[model samples]
Structure formats: structure tokens, C-alpha cells
Target: MGKTTGTRRGAWAAIRRLAASDRAAGLIMLGFALIGLVAANLPLTYHLFETIAETHIGIPYTNIDLPIGHWAQDGLLTIFFLTVGLELKQELTTGSLSNPKAAAVPMLCAVGGMLAPPILFMLVIALFSRFGPGEMGSLILTTTGSSIPFGEMAHGWAVPTATDIAFSLAVLALFARGLPGSIRAFLMTLATVDDLLAIILIAVFFSSVNAWYWFIGIAVCAGVWAYLVQLKRVPWAVVAVVGVLAWVMMFEAGIHPTLAGVLVGLSTPAREIHGETTPRAERYASKLQPFSALLALPIFALFATGVHFEELTPALMLSPLVIALIVALVVGKPLGIITTAWLSTHLGGLKMAKGLRVRDMIPTACACGIGFTVSFLIASLAYTNAELSAEARFGVLVGSLISALVSGILLSWQSKRFADATTDATR
Candidate 1:
């Protein structure tokens, strides 16, 4: 019994360590993604995998019958978003983002990164439309025997605008090891802002809120949550109940239920208001991050990225949407981030953190293109057709891979240069 207990303790310790590292999370998610893709494509496993993913679990007397894939996207993904909200709260209230001057560059970068992709995506389509009747024209024709409307295609413009915070930070952890913590801080702040913008876009454009009055209930629940959090003796169970009720209310309102996580996170006091053992943000993040990083994200990746190989034809690869996505993610993300950051430094008189250089920021900007999770979510929201959604996901995967590879190479060179300079100084 003692031996078994020791083994269990060791296993738990290892899991905790894995959860704590961004690199581990990234690698784990990447592995699961690969597994999903393989399972999706292999002749022997494809049918089984597709069946499982497509299986719908119905809730009796309710209209909540959704497939497993939808559950992963709408339900499981909320945990990851909750952690993101906590991080955002911490940064805005007390962390690096607290100082407006210090965060100016990243703030600009975030805005640029969000705006550029959709514009570029639409432009690519517009240019292709000028062709009138050609490869681009045929490509826009959906499987439904109808040509995709400009508005329908444009709805997907926001798909590539997101930056996958977990994956990008993981790459940074691996390649920029021993670098200044400020670099991580800069990336974190930028990605958090990028995500916040994505959330706003979803709420504004993607949502179809049928019953706006449900928001009144949501507001009430949120207010109650905030009140309980402010009390000297906090009732966490009550907070959890209220949070769920708020989520349900939002869901009923036709708004994305995940935003409730952000609401609760934003409602939490970032600092220690009641003289607690730890700050609310830190405590919640600690409690939740492990679940988000280790399980929620990887499972989502597995469910979301299972693209079949038959869809990867050369003509389809060269289609306008595919081209737009690749360009938006690979080119637009870094260009937008870097250009805006540079302009901010000049106009806002922003100063880089000590031990950080302009060149270092470039690769990190490149890394911003690694848009995976939220991008997938946007793709689903944008495209109802399975074929179009699959194409979008494929483009995201390819673009994110290119971004990661390019950023890794540049970061390695930067890391080497920094090491050489440090060694020379020591000499």
C-alpha cells in the first residue's frame, strides 16, 4: 500500500511539473494534434475516429444535443479561456500591462495584429474576384453548388487574426531560454490583448443573441459573483454556482457561454483585497492553469485538428481562401505587429525593457502568427460548410507551422548572439 501511494504521489508530481511548463503544454498539444491528424487520415482508423467525433450526446427535454467535437469547442475550451481571463486580469491590474507607458508597444502590436489579418484576407478575395471566371472563382464555389457570397467569405476574415497564446509562449520557452523575463512579459501582454480583441469580435460579429433580456440575468449573476468575491469570508461554492448560472444565462442569450469565464475572471480582484493567503487572480489561475494547459487545450487540439488528407489537393491548396489564410497568418501577423510596435516606439516614446533589443522583438513578432486555438474557433464560427471549415483549419495548421519554424530559427540566432555578447563581456 505504501509503495502504491509513493508511486501515485510521484505520478502526480510529474503531472504538475508538466502542467507548469509552457513548452510541455505546447509539445503535448502538438503531439495530440498529430495523433488526431493521423487518426483522421489513416484508412483503418478514419471511420472510427470520425464516428466518435461526430457522435451526439442528447440532453433529455433540452435542445442541447451537440456532437463531441462541438462539446470540445464550446464546453471544454471554456476552461482554457477562463485561464486566459485570469491572466488578462492580472496583467491589467498589477502585472506588466498595469503601466500604460510600458505596455504601449505591445498594445499597439496587439491592435495591429488583430486588424491586419482580416483586411488582408478580404483583399486577397477581392483581388481574386477581379479574375471573374477562373481558378479563384471556381474555388469560391461551395460544395452546395452555389458560389460563396462575398459577405459569407468575408465573415471568415477574423479566422486568422488570433494568436495562440499557449503555443506561442511554448515556443518562446523552448527557444528563448535564459532570456530576460521581459520578453515573456511582452509576448504575454501582447497575446492577452490579442485574445481580448478576438473575444470582442466574436461577441460583436459572430454572436446571434436571440434574447437580449437574458443579459439582465447574466448581469445580476455577475454582480452577485463580484459581491461574494469582495466579502471577507468568501463562499467559493456559491461563487461556482453563480458562475455556472451566469454561463447558462449567457448561453441562453445566444452569446458564447465562454465569455462568462472571462466575466468571472475580470470580476475577481487581482490583488489581495481581503488579506487572503494569495491574490485572487493568482489563486484562481493556479487552481485552473493546470487543468487548462494539461487537459483542456490538448483535448481541444485533438478534436479540432483532425483534418483528412483527401482534402489536400493542389488546386484546393492554391485556392483563394487558403492563400488568404496563409498570407494573413505568416506575413500579416509579423508585419502588423512589428510595424505597429516600431511606430509606437517612435510616436509613444516607448522604451524597451533592459537586456531586450529590437531584433529580439522581431522573432517574437513572427511567433505571434502561431494562431491555433482561437483561430480554429473563428473558422468554425465563420464557415458552416464542413469543407470550408476543413480548408480553413488546414491553412491555419500550415501557417502556424511556418510561423513556428521561422520564429524558432530567428530566435535561435538571436539567442546565440546574446550568448556570444555575454561571454565576451565576461572575458
Candidate 2:
């Protein structure tokens, strides 16, 4: 019994260590994504994987019924968003974002990053319409042999605008050794703001309200949560129950349920309360980060990346939509970020963090091109046609992979330069 208990303890310790590692989390999610892709393409396993993903399991008589895939995307993914919210709150209250002067550059850069992708997407569509497979003014044909109108195709403009905070941060942690800490801070601020913008886009464009009155329940739950967290001894169980109720309300209200996680996270107090030394937001983020990193994100990646590559043809691969998405993420993201940062610092009178220059931001800009998580979510929400959606997702996957590889290489090079400079200084 003693030996067994010790082994169990050891296993638990190892699991915790893995969960806490950003590199491990990123690698695990990537591995699972590859597994999902392979599983989706293999004839023998495709049907099984599809069945598992499509199967629904939810409480009866509730509006919570969703397929396993959606449960990962909308349900389990909320935990990760909640952690993001907590981190955002901390940054706003006390971290990098607290100072308006310091925050301006990243905020503007985030706006630039968001704006460029959609413009590029529209430009690509215009080019395709004017030049490819149709008359100068006619609809462009898609890989699925459908000619969608320009307006319909434009719905996917937001798909490549997102930057996956988890993946971008993971790459930075893994490859950015010996670089300035300010770079990480800048990346975190930029990614957080990027996510905030994506959340707004999801709420504004993607939501289809069925019952507006359900927001009353959400408000009440949020109120209760705010109240509970302020108590001397917070009732964590009650807080969790209230949070679930808020999510249900949000879902029933026709808003995306994941927003509830952000709502609750923002509601959590960032200041120390009840004589606690550490703030509740920081503690909550620390506790939840492991779960978000280990399970929620990997599961979401598994379903989100299960694109059937076997179905893609060479012509489809070269489709205007695919080309646009890839270009928007890979080229537009970095271009917008670097340009905005440079303009903000040089022209707009905003200063970057000390010892940081526009040139130092190149790798960070490339890292911002990793539009995986929220990008995948937006792709599904952007298109009702299954084939179009799959193609859009494929574009996101390829674009994000290219961004990751490029950013990793750049970060390593930058780290080596920094190391060499330090060695020379020591001499």
C-alpha cells in the first residue's frame, strides 16, 4: 500500500509538472492536432472519429445540448478563455496595461493587426473576381465548385484576424531564451488585446439571439459571482455553480456562451481581498492555467484541426479563399503589427518599452501571425457551407503552422544574437 501510494504521488507530481510547462502544452496540442488530422484522413478511422466528434451529450430538457466537437469548442474552451480574462484583468489593474502610455503601442498594434487581415481578405476576393474563373464583375468560384457572391465570401474576413495567445506565448517561451523580458510583455499585451477584439467580433457578428431575456439570468449570476468572490471566505463551489448558470443563460440568450467565461474572469477581483497576500485573479489564473493548458486547449485543438486533407485537390489548394487566408495571416499580421508599432513609436509620439525598438519586434510580429484558436472558431462561424468551412479551417491550419515555424526560427536567431552580444560584453 505504501509503495502504491508513493507511485501515485509521483505520477501526480509528473502530471502537474507537464501541465505547468507552456512548451509541453504547446507540443501536446500540436501532437494532438496532427493525430486528429491523420485520423480524419485515414479511411479506416475517419468514420469513427467523425462519429465521436458529432455525438451529442448534454443535460436533457436544457438548451445545452451540443455535439462533442462543440463541447470542446464552446464549452471546454471557455475555461481557457476564462484564464485569459483573468490574466487580462490582472494586466489592466496592475500589470503592463495599467499605464496608458505604456499600453498605447501594443493596443494600436493590435488594431493594425486586426484591420489589415480583413482588408487583405477583401482585396484577395476582388482580385479573384476580376481575374479568375469569372467575368470582371461576377462571383468567384470556390473549390467546392460553387460560385459564392462577394458579400458571402467576405464573411470569412475575420477568420485570419485572430492571434492564438496560448500558441504564440508557448512559442515565445520555448524559443525566446536570452531575449529581453519586455518582448514577452509586449507579446502578451498584444495577444490579449487581439483576443479581446476577436471576442467582440464573435459577439457582434456571429451571435444569433434566440431569447434576449436570458441575459437577465446571466446578469443575476454575474452579480452573485461578484458578490461571492468578495466574501471573507469565498464559496468556490457556489461560485462555480453560478458560473455554469451564467454560461447557460448566455447560450440561451443567443450570445456565444464562451463570453460568460470572460465575463466571470473580468468580474473576479484583481486586488488582494480578505487579507490574502496574493490577488484572487492571480491565484485563480494560476490554478486554472494548468487545466486550460492540459485538457481544454488540447481537446479543442483535436476537434478544430481534424480537417480532411485527403479531400483537398491541387486546384482547391490554390483557391482564392485559401490563398487569401494564408496570406492574411502570414503576411498581413506581421506587416500590420510592425508597421503600426513603428508608426506609433516614431510618428505618433508613443514610446515602446525601454530597450525595445521597432526592429526588435519582428519576431514578435511573426508570432502574432499564429491565428489558431479563435481563428478556427471564427472560420466555423463565418461559413454555413460545410465544404467552405473546412477549406477555411485548412487555410488557418497551414497559415498558423507557417507562422509558428517562422517565428520559432526568428526567435532562436534573436536569442543567439543576444547571447553573442552578452558574451562580447563580458569580454
TM-score of each: 0.92, 0.95
Clashing pairs in 2: none
Q: Give the top-scoring candidate (TM-score).
A: 2
RMSD of each: 2.6, 1.9
lDDT of every predicted structure (CA atoms)? 0.83, 0.88
The sequence of per-residue lDDT tens digits that candidate 1 reaches over residues 308-394 is 757444676676677889999989998898878777766767877776655669989999999998998889888986767887887
lDDT of 1: 0.83
Query: What C-alpha lDDT, on a 0 to 100 scale, does residue 177 get in candidate 2?
Result: 94
For residues 1-427, write the lDDT of model 2, one tens digit per residue. 9999999999877887887776888888888887887788889988999999999999778857899998999899999989988988998899878886878999899999999988898899888877545556568788766787777778899999999887898899899999998999899889888988898999999999886678788888989998998898888899989999988888888888999999999999999987899999998998887788888988888898886654646676687788899899988999999999988888998998898889999998998988988998899889997767888888898888999999999999999999999999999
Residue 165, model 1: Cα distance from true site in angstroms: 1.1
Q: Model 2: runs farther than 4 Å from truth?
A: 1-13, 132-135, 313-315
